[model samples]
Target chain A: MGPSLSIAGLEVRDPRGRVLLSVPALDVPSGALVGVEGPSGAGKSTLLFALAGLVAARGHVRWGAQDILALGSERRAAFRRETIGMIFQDFLLFEELSAADNAALSALFHPRKARAGLRARARENLTRLGLSGTGARNVTSFSGGERQRVAIARAMASNAPVLLADEPTASLDRAAADRLIDDLVTFVRRTGTTLIAVSHDPRLIARMDRVLRITDGTVSGDTTPNTAEGAQ
Target chain B: MMAVWNALPALWQDIVVMLLLLAPSVVLGGVVLRGFAPWPLVRAILWRFRGASVLFVALIAISVGMGIGLLAQERGLRQGTAQAADKFDLVIAAPGSEITVMMASVFLQPSDMALLDGVTYNEIANAPNVAVAAPLAFGDSYGAAPVIGTTAAFASYLAEGHITGRMWATSSEALAGTLVPLDIGDSFTPAHGHGDGADAGAHGGAQLTITGRLAPTGTPWDRAILVPVETVWEVHGLANGHAPERGAQIGPPFDPAYFPGTPAVVVRSDALWANYALRSDFTRDRETMAFFPGAVLAQLYQVLGNIREIMSLLVLVTQMLVTAAVLLGLFILSRLFRRQIALLRALGAPARFVFAVVWSFGAALLLAGAVLGLGTGIGAASVLSRVVSARTDIVITAPLGWAELHFLAGFISVTLILSLVPAVMVLRQPVVPSLRS
Candidate 1:
């Protein structure tokens, strides 16, 4: 359903031109759930930003045969709109908008998606996430767990091939985090959507198909732990 | 909103029509925003920042709307007075300023010009090409409104005027203007001097009978009480304890010792060139002043023109300040929503789309304000015009014209230009850094 990505000479630099990340090469299988594991300040989010072309970087990020980094910024943004759905760590929902409107942003601006079609899909996705009446109420009225669920619903509603979550469970409690991850895994497996989630929580990492461990801005190994080998 | 619509359908329709009329630009602006920002995103963000948006729009509407309305009112004042002035050929007065004569005589307002000898009246009537000379003597008031001492010829000058009760057949009887606010049978004391404040002592306790009422004339004269010259002279003679000799006529040896001063003389000449000749002679004379009312009006309008320029400058500055208010509002919104903009960008909103979102919000605020202001301004102008017309007898009607159209167009353009201030701020931030943290 989506392109397998290959990365080479991928590096991220800070405002003062200091190197923040330096990954020489990596590859991601199509339609797979890959967990990015790293310590604090080890460039876990920067890797995703580069792949999405949200930041300036020196890289050859080949999505299938097409080089994502070689494309211009405008085309890269367009490509991301077509292929990627991002979940921010803080769950930055537009408070003035309804939860259904929050989820419908991904396809609301697309040429082929009618407003009614996008809203219908948004309501469907939000209902699946157990937010049945969220289409009419404001987002600020929802709880933290519900807010993240709405964000996950946004990612799912876009129907994009690649779902990138930036510590989506960072602020959720133990029970809420467990429930959110379970729903995310279920949705990903059912839809065959490729998910690349970054997290340090052991329980979350223990459920991924494979874990790519990075330390000091470089991939150390394909550290697919023995505990996660039996997970669907 | 639905309940209100169901309860009062007619009121709802009226409100909807009024809103649409006030800000027709909102429809155009909505279409424009759909292309770049898409209506959903622009609308959602605008709802959050609606308070600031509404304030900015109201500021624009009041300033621009009131400015145009006041300008049109001023124009009506000038036009009405100018047209009235054109009907008179020349006004003769005591040796003083021409404007005083025009105001005191034709418009029937009080003046301080030293009264000319009744002998001067003889000179105007005897001059070649002189068709009629209606001398005006002012000294008393009926209920504090000016009472004019004029002739039977005064009625012929008005476009529509007729006696209702009967003509003044006695020296103690009076013909009232439509604005006197009295019945034909009632009586009132005539106050001496001008009618501004405390009344001066009357002429021989001059309680006169209201014999007749004249029809309306849309001039200041409508507020006056017209009396026969003999009635005015008799009041003066009675006050001075002198009786008029029974059959006296005006000439060199002023008979009956009647020396009632004439404040103004409205003269009509048979030959057009007679006006220039008469004016030149009076200009050289030491005891008399003569001028065409039209020339006096032109000089007055020159002063009004300078005032118009100053008012126009003030209007322009006020418009700029209104635009600045909109800019300030949008700047605060842009700052408050910086994180949201970054999030939208990370979620695949282009920089162009972000810029469009900021500009569209500003445009909506300004468009709404200007349209509402215009409706309010026009409404005020209409009401004020009628009120002023009734009070002053100067017909005031502010028709919708280029002044209103230009006000709306210029205001919309300037505000749209100022909107770039916030839009540029939205585009200048580094999206990745904001999304990361």
Candidate 2:
């Protein structure tokens, strides 16, 4: 299959003269669990931010044939809503909302998307993440692991074509992290959607279809994932 | 209207009424619903602005409510005063201000104005088109009510107010109004003068008989004690320690100047032209002040109306300024919520999401305040009317009509429209910078 994502000559710089991120060329296949790994201050998150159109960057970030970065701000936001799901390191779940509402809020902007439909999908996502029947509780009542699952549920509930999860399991224990990796791989395989995850854990990175590392503001060539971990 | 009135949850109807009044403006916002929906974002943001919303609604209620209440009370006061005078066709007193005499006779307020001579009474009665005339003698009180000394004809002019027993046939008898707490054959001694000790019983053993009680007319007459002029003369003689009878009897060659120095005289006429002519004649006389009571009432309303108009303008301006300040504060508070707005925007919400969040907050505050104020103002006015009736005989009957509705509409419209300013400002703000910060 053709690459689900294509990047070309993308570069990001701070207002000062320092370059923060650079990628010459890259392509990611659909349904691939691509992992990004980097040391502290290596511009890993910056590169992810640029790919998500959350930061100003030079050059092209195309989803298939469409250059999403070249789209107008409004259209880009709409495209992001419809196509790209984001899971941040800190878990950007809305604290004021119940877990269900936090997840359902993502789909509300879609035309003809009824509240009932969104909540049903959100409930399905929450249940898949081992958060069954916890939809009505406020997110503040949830544990850190529970909150992370809620964030994942919010990202996945909208059924966006791509998910950019930065350090998706950073705050999780080994067992919870392993479970999340297993769940994410299963979700990707079923939906045939692109999953680009950044993690410091070798166990998480090792399960990816392909892995890319950021070193000295530049991305390294891809490495094959541990087939044993993927199979498990 | 009945359906709206049924919701008795303290000012809820006022809020609903205010919203209904502002429906056209709110409906204008319906156009935005086609391409965008921001209610989710609106609901969340309002949660954060809960305290500000309370403050906003409270301000609106006081400003708008007080405005409405004052206008209503003034209208009632004006109408009640006017209706009180509507009974008497013309009031004749010793030459002075016509309104002063009308106020003294119909309103029962004691004044220092000169009293009409018995000659003036005779002249008023004999005037063209004059059907009946009755002399009025004041300066006496009986238990928080005025003792008005007039002939039997005075009761006829006070519409719908008739005696049950009889119209005080002898000088010692009296007729009390419905509010006076006296019935047939109830005898109470007269008080000395018009002061607080109305039951001081200072008159020299002049026990007055309540021959009958008058029915309620919803006017100052509902609070009076009617007696013949002879009873008052007898009471005055008892107070001053003089002879019992005011003799100058009723026959030909008898003196018409029997009750000289009587405080007032009321007349009724058949033809409008004759009444006008008599009024003109008496008004020109150096001896008497003639009042077409309606004209005097009109003058009173004109003065009060002008004052009320000024007060209304002041209230309107104050409300506008307060609303503007509230909006300005809202705009500033919204800036504090910029991070939230940016977060919503980042969540792929449209600019309308931010706008709706801010606008809904502002609108809710103003609407709540306006409604609360409306109920408070109306309730306060009603209470004040009763207090005034109990303490002084002046009755206020404030009207609620198109004018009040118009004021309410204007209030809601202005507030909603002003809220848009803050909404627009929030909508136009750069989303990315706020998120980053």
Candidate 3:
């Protein structure tokens, strides 16, 4: 089962001491499909980064029983490896590696016995995502949409409980984006995985069970479209 | 273990030392990569920047090759020259430069010097414990080959009984060296001097027949032609070192009254103590000087050894500087892939894993270059040996030895240790900022 997240007094500041992101309180239940929406420079990506414990922030970000923000950098990386899978906007793939190898890159740091399974799963994920024969091709030769799908496959390869994606479909065409949204939602529902994605795409946001809208580094709206959970 | 090590041959001992010196790098690599296999990633990086990798490796190889080639060539030359003089145990000459006489007699390099007169030669020949005292007459040439005149006993002793045919039985019969370009029974007229300045017609019609050939000695003597000393004296209008009543006898037991002076005399004794005694007795005489050719060669080798040490130091320093520059280049190259490194970090890869990737990348290049440099050194040494042999007529063989392997081991260990610097610098970069960039 995916872990629930409980956060409080979360804030991120820039080098010049200006606030970049501030979240007073937030709660995400297990297996929730949530969307974060905001204009440019609205701290949407920063929030995703903080949730993954990738940036320095002050607060309690308790995923299940472990407070990730209170842990050291090494422990946080371990937490991310075991529990959180992240997808970035630009589809950061090693250009020199084949699509399958890039998808299974985490196998490099995994235990020796676990590496083969991870690689097999990565290839399976690529095949399921419409990249069957392309798994052996280098990512540098991939189109923008194909590269984005490879990044999605990589994020899901570990079967991590919590997945945080920032603009995952921004580089894909409308048809590819729709296909990706269907794949993500079906995988989340079947596996009871919590997926929190930050995107400005209306189609993506409308499919989420819960949505949070932020403006100027502060949350402005919170709603459950299928339920009666009120705004913040 | 100590006993076992001591029981091994010298070459084996050096091989063990070379392996021991490389152990630290190997152990460190194993520890650093304890749970990780960074080779795939390292291979990718190497292939990605193969141009830079090749450039760095070539730079290292050339420097190492030059250093090892020079050392091997120096050792080969020393050994070759020493081996050339091996037969000349002691040289007795007029009160003058021992080097000049040694060169004239042992190396067959002709030079003008005062000769040891009949009295000095008679004393040396009759000295107690003197097994063989052969006069050397060297002032003639046959083409580019020097024509030396000495007794049949000395010629037989120098060849170590490896002559292909019987020793010369008459003054007109000659023994050709292995490389003299003459066949048995072939005859040649002697020139009065060496090189282009030689008087080719000076000995008009005074021909000497080749009756024997010496086995290869891998020395300057390989190109010499040997005849009886009486032949040299008679051709120059001097007495044949015998009374007229003695007839045409060519062996020894010469009459001092009829002996013509010779440029140098090579002396030997069966007993080591007797050679020292002979040297002392010959040196005490005011008319002549005696010295061990081995001792003089040792003194020359000491000087050569000192120069080799200095050259080794300079090469070492230059290699270190080049390694440092290459490592710094590695740092800049690592920056080119900073984003990829940052991405790996964000994907929850441990810092040690990334460090291993970069460090192993650098270490692989160093090791490849070092191993390839060994071949380059051997090839370069072989080529240089041929050139030196061609120029000096001394067969020098500069095979790669334990010293070059030790040098390679030390280079690999030091550079592998230094490789950690770039890995650490890469780790110190901020992951989030790099990812963003």
Candidate 4:
């Protein structure tokens, strides 16, 4: 319906002045479950970090129409807190807190109408992700699939328009990975939130509404349809 | 107060040494105490200096020692001055071998008294505007115990405030002052060695009866013996039945009354003529020195001013070192815990909040150290006062004013600086590195 993220002339380089990746332009519409596919060390994760404003790079990363990189550091931080939700490939939950607490922590910088009820919302989100009984348990105790769900739940809990996940299903088995992708896609569709998932998994790649291949830091269009029958 | 009190016993037994040693170092640059303070953070810092606190404590100990030494000198001067005051308007004792030691020990001689233009107690009793004049006779000790012989009129000068008994009358009767409280039935035997032993009868000499008792005054009198000067001469003369009758050619080894001549100590009305210029406060006769123990004490403090200055400088130096150590500890510890701090920053905590969390720990350690230093200082002074008084018969009370001030300044000053240094860095380093390895 509307453009959620627009990247133009994205260029990432290593510290020693070696070219790593270059993307001419890429745009993901809102509510689209876009899959970013690449081999190992192909600048997929770096792309995510740069787009999230977590790294220094020469690029134009626009959220809705505003260029996020153009914002001052302080204002950019505020904007990242408000608009961007990130999920690490490793499910980087704080080891000291429970699953629900980790989910709620993502919204720490977000302003809420009733701040006191944030934890309850976090618990509801965890339950919706099949973590109903694991709400109070530390994320460290969870399996890979469960941790992935927790991460996905946390990303969605922020209610940001753009969600960036790094290999969310890389460590999960087929059944669990399918369930996590189903939850993610269902949530993103229901909330009209745009999703960008990085992975090399062909099953996950095939499930996305659209797929973009990143090779030597270059992205190009793939005209594959969203029909599951043809891919199966 | 509760925490301080609870920390006392432990502080004395264990912490005092570290407190002494590290107190200076902490004052100097010891980091361990500043680190590991219990303030919780998204992350906390730690320092590994167990030895630095010791050095800090030692630096402070010197200050404490010098402070105690000064108090000792002052108290000595006080007792000495009080002694010189009662001896005469001023005491004309031998100047000590050294200038410093001279003030600490000086005694009036009999020949020195003869040089004064003074009158005896009986002669001055009727003088206009005269209250009383009590002559002092000191010399001959009984087993190292000084035997002071003075009249009842001397009691008023010795008494600082209220006491139990009044001055006594009659030659044989004497009153015990606060310094030496003797019951009415107590008898004082004159110490021997003077030629008056044969006429005085037995061991030392004549035995004097105690007729009255004095109240407890916190002055030097509490430690001195009070008796009539007449008894002193009587003891010297050995006034007994054995005395040679009417000067009938008496010599030693002949009759029981025959005795050898010893040093003469007497107080007569006509022989002594002394004028204490009451109008002139400090300027007294140059020939005769009226050593006010208070004045002597002030002078001694001035002389020892250098030592006091050294001690104060040491304290200041240690304070600087402690500040540096705390700063270093903060920087290193903060660096170590940067990731966690960033995480907390990400959690919406402001820079001030993060800094405050870390500073709370430093405050706790400093508080512990301060309590330790103070407890040790006060306790040592108290025990020393008792021991010195017991052994030397000198009542020297340690002055707590400077000790307390130094402790307060040291504790508050160092603690405030240590707590504040690490906190300021938070303002500049607010943004956490986006990807912490």
TM-score of each: 0.85, 0.85, 0.92, 0.61
Candidate 4 segments exceeding 4 Å error: A1-3, A31-41, A86-232, B1-161, B164-276, B279-286, B303-306, B345-434
Tell me the tens digit of each residue's lDDT in model 4 across A61-149. Answer: 88888887676655665666567777755675655567886777644444445333566766777887788989889777898888877
* Higher-lDDT candidate of 3 and 4: 3
Model 1 over residues B1-437: C-alpha lDDT tens digits? 77867787775555554554445445545544565535576787678777776676678778877777877777777777876675578878877788778887767666677776656777776788877677777877866467777666654455344778877665567777777787797776677777466365656577878888887666777677877666676666632112345423222222224556677878878888998887776664678888999888888889988988898889778878767866886887787778888877777766667777777777777778878888867887788888887776666678755556666665676567668678888778877777764
Q: Which digits, one per residue and each the tens of the lDDT, describe model 3 over residues B256-289?
A: 8898888888998888898889888888556779
TM-score of 1: 0.85
Ranked by TM-score, the better of candidates 3 and 4 is: 3
* TM-score between candidate 3 and the true structure: 0.92
Best by lDDT: 3
Minimum summed lDDT over a 10-residue window in model 4 chain B is located at B259-268
| Model 2 residue A161 CA deviation in Å | 0.6
Cα deviation at A93, candidate 3, in Å, is 2.4
Model 2, residue B408: C-alpha shift (Å): 1.9
**Candidates 2 and 3 compared by lDDT, better number:** 3
Candidate 1 regions off by >4 Å?
A112-116, A225-231, B1-37, B83-89, B106-109, B116-132, B195-197, B238-259, B268-284, B379-399
Every candidate's DockQ is 0.51, 0.38, 0.66, 0.11
lDDT of the candidates, in the order given: 0.74, 0.74, 0.87, 0.55
Ranking by DockQ: 3, 1, 2, 4
